[model samples]
Target: MRVLVTGGAGFIGANFVHQTVRERPDVHVTVLDALTYAGDEASLSDVASAITFVRGDITDSPLVDRLVGEADVVIHFAAESHNDNSLSDPWPFVHTNVVGTFTLLEAVRRHGVRYHHISTDEVYGDLELDDPAKFTDQTPYNPSSPYSSTKASSDLLVRAWVRSFGVQGTISNCSNNYGPYQHVEKFIPRQITNLIDGVRPKLYGTGQNVRDWIHVEDHNTAVWAIVERGQIGRTYLIGADGEVDNKSVVETLLELMGQPADAYDLVSDRPGHDMRYAIDASTLRSELGWTPQYGSFRDGLAATIDWYRANEGWWRPRKDATEAKYATMGR
Candidate 1:
């Protein structure tokens, strides 16, 4: 099978490429990525010999069209995904998340290619802190940030293309993913890296914002399940039922790293910070008979911390700049 993975150099996408190359010998993989700030080409270095890599933007219509035409399947993971970045400048998010998706949809529709869209549960805005409701595939989008709003726009575009143009595609909105190769600017990796450097971890607001977490490997596995088995024009919610607040996460990290639990500092929250997010992945679980491999969030987090520790070379280069940016934003 010929598989084209957009943003395959980025965090979750890179892990998906690694997993695909490691596990599926029969598939030929091609990666299309712009190598943005968050995207590290080195993430795919270990698997460099096995796949074709194209350093290009998804918003480039001709490139997207050509890549889509040659693929048996396309899994789009490209986007400007950081909520804080989106808040600082919404234009990039709108362009890449919305226009880029449109470009891919046009190409896939033209080529009759099987496609799967990777999205975020943040598109459903956030739930109340005490609310028990979880975001299902049926949940209406109520995006709270520029990043998520653009994602919501992209998801809607995919849905419209599926229904109106008969594009053979599926979409999955996943919860927060933490594992290897993740950019340091993201929440989990940032805290892990800070703790590693003997710097106190910083928390936004009161550290009470709840997020449903999943291992990136689990997320990619679920994506494959949906790609191979999901019905066309359908959407799936992917999660592992791992929900924890920011404070608990930091405390656990401190515990794992042998530091005092209260060593972290709390900073003022970013604008429009969502209170909570949770995903109800019952449809995916029941229909596909797929389950998350990471049974314990703490165990997964420990493993992630180990990755950052053992391979400082991979994340160290990106660390200072990311923290500098955050310092400017006071996040």
Candidate 2:
């Protein structure tokens, strides 16, 4: 099988490429990434010799069509996904998320290739911190930020294409992901790198926002399962049932890194922050017979910290700029 991974240099997509090369040596792999600030070729360094890597934008119809035509399957993971960045500027999100998906759908439809979409649980908006409900496949679309709204729009495009155009594809809306290769701009990596620099971690607002965290490896594993066995046109939710509040997450990081739990600073929160996000991954688990290997959030976090500590060279270059952006937002 020849697989095309869009945004394959980004955090989750890079990890997916690595896993495929490691476990499925017979499969030919081609990666298409824009190499944005969020996508780093260095993340795919170890597998550099194993796969074909193409640095290009997905919205380029000719490039996308040529690439999608050559692949047996295309896994779409590209997006402008930082909520804060989308809040400040939404055009990039719409172009990349919505228009890019449309471009891919058209190419896949023309080539008769199987396609899979990677999305997020943030598309369901937020559940109240006190709410007992979790996001399910049956959940309604209620995106809050420009990021989630555009993602929701892209997802709708895939569904419509599958129904009207008969494009063979599946979709998975996953929860928060944390692991190596993740940019320092994200929550888990940012705090881990801050503590590595002997800087206090910054908590936004009262730090009560909750997220369902899953290791990147587990999310990628589920993606592969869906690619192999999932029903076309069906949407799957991928999660590990790892839920942690922002405050507790910081404190846990402090404890794991041998610092006092309260050694972090509080900052103003971003606008349109969602209260909580949780995923019901029962479909991925029961229907596809998949389960998370990182069942414990702390254990997964510890492993992530170890990776950042052991590979400072990879994330160091981006640290200052990321913090400066957060500082401007007073977060």
Candidate 3:
């Protein structure tokens, strides 16, 4: 099988590539990435010789057309994905998430290639902290941030393409992913790296905002299961049933790192911050026979801490700049 992965050098996409190369020797993988601020070529360093890398933007019609034309499947993961960054400048989010998705849809429609879109659970907006309900396939779209709005638009585009143009495609909205190669700008990595550097972890708001966490490998495993076994034109929610509040997550990190549970600072909260997000991935689980391997969030988190500790070389260069950006925002 030939697979063309957009944003393959980024954290989650890079992990997908590493896992694919290790498990699926018959598959030839090609990565198309813009090498933006969040995209790192070094993330794919270990499997450098195993896959082909193309440096290009997903919005380039000709490049996207050529790449999609040659592939049996195209997994779209390229986008401006940070909520903080999107809130600062929404143009990149609109251009990359909405326009780039349109570009890919057109290419896939023209070539009749199988396409899978990667999305986030944030598109359904936040659930009240006490709500037992979780986001399901039938959940209505209710995006909060510029980042998620664009993602929601992209998801709609994929659905329209499938119905109107008969494009072979599937979509998956995954929960918060934490694993190796994640950028330090994200929540889990920021706190983990801060503790490693003897800096206090910063908590936003009251630190009660809840997120459904999932290991990147588990999420990607579900992605592959959908590609291989799922019906076309369906959307799958990928999660591991790992739900943790911000404060508790920080406390766990502190405990694992041998710091006081309360060794953290409260900072300004982000604008329009959602209270919580949860996912009901029953469709992917029961229908596709997929289940998470990471049964314990703490165990997965501890492994992630170890990865960042051992890979300081990969994350150090970006640490100061990320923290500086956050500092200037008073977050």
Candidate 4:
């Protein structure tokens, strides 16, 4: 099948691009990205020759329509992701996450194409530390942050289109993802990069916030499963059953790097920080018979750390770009 992967140049998206091409040689994939600071083309450089890369924003209805019309399936992954960045300003999140999803939904509806949405579990808000609150397909959304609120809105739009217009589609909300090719602004990679630079690893809040972590590769696999085998007009929760407190994650990194636990710095948490997040992925497993291949968080963390250690050049430039932006504002 010919598929269009929106925002496929970004971290998880780029990994999806590579994995898709490798797994299904017969499927042709097209990636549409705005090439934002977060959407670096270099991440997909290795597979650049194989996949169709279109540097465009998802809000462009005409572009999205054209691409959707030519493909059998569209995987919508484009969005302004990052809670810290979202809180500083929310307009971009609305423009990309909300309006962009609307644009893609309209395009896919007109084209009569099947679509899949890649969403985050943050939409369910925080679970009480002592009480379990794993978000399932039936969970009601209670997004607290700008990033999640906008994502929740986007998800609503997708559901509306499916029910009202009979658009063939499925949505998969996944837990926190960590792996190689990720931008350094994210929690795991940022902490890893800082540790490697001999700087204190910054932990948001008490670092007690809990999140169900899944490797990006496994998340991509789940997405493909939804696209290929999932039921139409349904939402699936994709998780690795790997849950950990933020402090524990940092401590694990320290142990892996042979650093002292005191090497961490407890910083002010981002506004509206969720206390915990987990996902009930039984729907995907029972329906699609999909299981996570990466079950051990320790193994995943070790492999991811090694990847960053071995590929400094990739992340160094990204960090430099963010630092440059800060410099520009200061000047």
Candidate 5:
């Protein structure tokens, strides 16, 4: 099988590439990436010789059409994903997320290629901290950030293409992901790298916001399962039941790094910060027989911390600038 992956150099996408190359020798993989600030070719260094890499934007229709035509399947993982950055500038998010998905849909529709879209739980908005409810496949869309709103719009575009144009595709909305090659700007990596630099971690607001954390490996595994066995036009939520609060996450990182639990600062929160996000991945589990290998959040976090510590060269270059950007927002 020949697979074309969009945004394949970014965090989760890069991890997906690595996983596919290592496990599926029968498959030939081609990566299409824009190489933006968040997309680093260095992330794919270990697998540089194994796959074809194309530097281009997903919004380019001719390029997208040519790439999508050559592939047996296309996995769409490209997006302007950071909520904080989207608040500052939403146009990039709309262009890349909304318009890019439309471009891909048109290409896939024309060529009759199978496509898989990666999305987030943020599209379902937030649940109260105490609510037992989790985001399900039937959850209503109520995005709170420009990032998520664009993602939601893109998701709707995919559904429309599938129904109106008979495009063969599936969508998976996952929760927070953490693992190697993740940008230092993200929450887990930010706190881990800060502690590595002997700096205190910063928490937004009172640090009560909650998220369902999943290891990147687990998330990618679920994506592959959906591509192979999932029903077309169906949406699946991918998670490991790893729901954790921001405060506890910071405290845990501090403890893991041999610092006091309270050795962190509370910063001004971003606007429209969701109170909590949880995913009900029952469909991915029971329907497709998918399961996460990382059963413990702390164990997964420990592994992620070790990855950043061991590969300082990969993340260190971006650390200072990322922290500076956060400082401006009081995050």
Candidate 6:
């Protein structure tokens, strides 16, 4: 089988490509990536030769159309994914997440190919004060930030295409992912690098925001299952069923490193930060017979810390960039 993985040079996308090549030696994989700041080709260094890489944007209608026509399957993982970045400049997010998705959907419809969309649990917004926040396939979108709002809009576009054009496809909304090769700008890696550098990690608000955590490898495995055996026009929620309070996650990482809780500094929260996000994975489990294969929240935190400690060169430069950007914003 031939497949096209958009954003294949990014964190989760790269992981998916590596795993796909290792598991299915016969499958030919093509990657289309724009190599944005967050997407480092270095992440896929070990698996480079096994797959074809194209540096291109998803919104380039002709390029996407041609790639979609060539492959039997298309897995879209490209987007401007940082929440703070979205809050500061939403236009880029809309263009990549919403417009780019529409472009791909149109291409798929015209070409008649199987497609899979990688979405996030954040689109469901924060849970009510007294209610559980686990989002299901049927949950109404209540996005609280521009980043999630655009993702929600993109999800709607995919559903509309399916309903209108009978596009053969499936969707997976996953929780916060943490594992190797994640960009240092993300929360987990940013905090890990900061704390280890003798700098205080920044905690937004009271750090009470809660998010379900999944290892990238487990998330990629779930995606592979859906692409292979999932029913068309269905949405699956993928997660490790592990939820961690932001403060507690930071504290756990500190403990593993023999550092103190005060190793972090409390900063003003991002605008419209969702209080908590969660997801119900029962549908994915029953339909795909899939479950996570990773450490729990606490154990995952431990493992993540060790990874950052061992890969300083991979994260230090990004950490410096993050600090410079944050410093300029503060100024």
Compared with the true structure, the alpha-carbon lDDT of candidate 4 equals: 0.89
TM-score of each: 0.99, 0.99, 0.99, 0.96, 0.99, 0.96
lDDT of 4 by residue, 203-278 (tens): 8778999999999999999998898898898999999999899999999999899998767977676678888898
For candidate 5, give the lDDT of residue 145: 92
- Ten-residue segment with the worst summed lDDT in candidate 4? 322-331
Residue 26, candidate 2: alpha-carbon lDDT: 89
lDDT of 6 at 41: 84
Which residue runs of candidate 4 sit more than 4 Å off their true CA positions? Answer: 321-331
Full-model lDDT, candidate 6 = 0.88
Residue ranges of candidate 6 with Cα displaced over 4 Å: none
Assess candidate 1 and give its TM-score to the true structure.
Answer: 0.99
lDDT by residue (tens digit), candidate 5, 1-331:
9999999999999999999999999999999999999999999999999999999999999999999999999999999999989999999999999999999999999999999999999999999988999999999999999999999999999999999999998999999999999999999999999999999999999999999999999999999999999999999999999999999999999999999999999988889999999999998999999999998999999999999999999999999999898877767
Candidate 6 all-Cα RMSD: 1.5
Tell me the lDDT of model 1 at 146.
92
- Please give, for residues 1-331, the per-residue lDDT of candidate 3 as tens digits: 9999999999999999999999999999999999999999999999999999999999999999999999999999998999999999999999999999999999999999999999999999999998999999899999999999999999999999999999999999999999999999999999999999999999999999999999999999999999999999999999999989999999999999999999999998999999999999999999999999998999999999999999999999999999999989998
Mark the regions of model 5 whose C-alpha exceeds 4 Å error after superposition.
none
Q: Report the number of clashing residue pairs per model.
A: 0, 0, 0, 0, 0, 0
Q: Give a tens-digit lDDT track for model 6, residues 1-331.
A: 9999999989899889889999989999999999999888887888888999999999999999999999999999998899889878899899999999999999999999999999999998888535765789998988888899999999999988999899998899999999888988888888888778877778888888888899998999999999989999999999888877899888887887788866777887778888777789998888789988875777767777888899887777677777889887661
Point out the worst 10-residue segment of candidate 2 by lDDT: 322-331
Regarding lDDT, does 4 or 5 come out ahead? Answer: 5
Q: Give me the displacement of residue 94 in model 5, in angstroms.
A: 0.3
lDDT of each: 0.95, 0.96, 0.96, 0.89, 0.96, 0.88
Candidate 5 achieves a global lDDT of 0.96
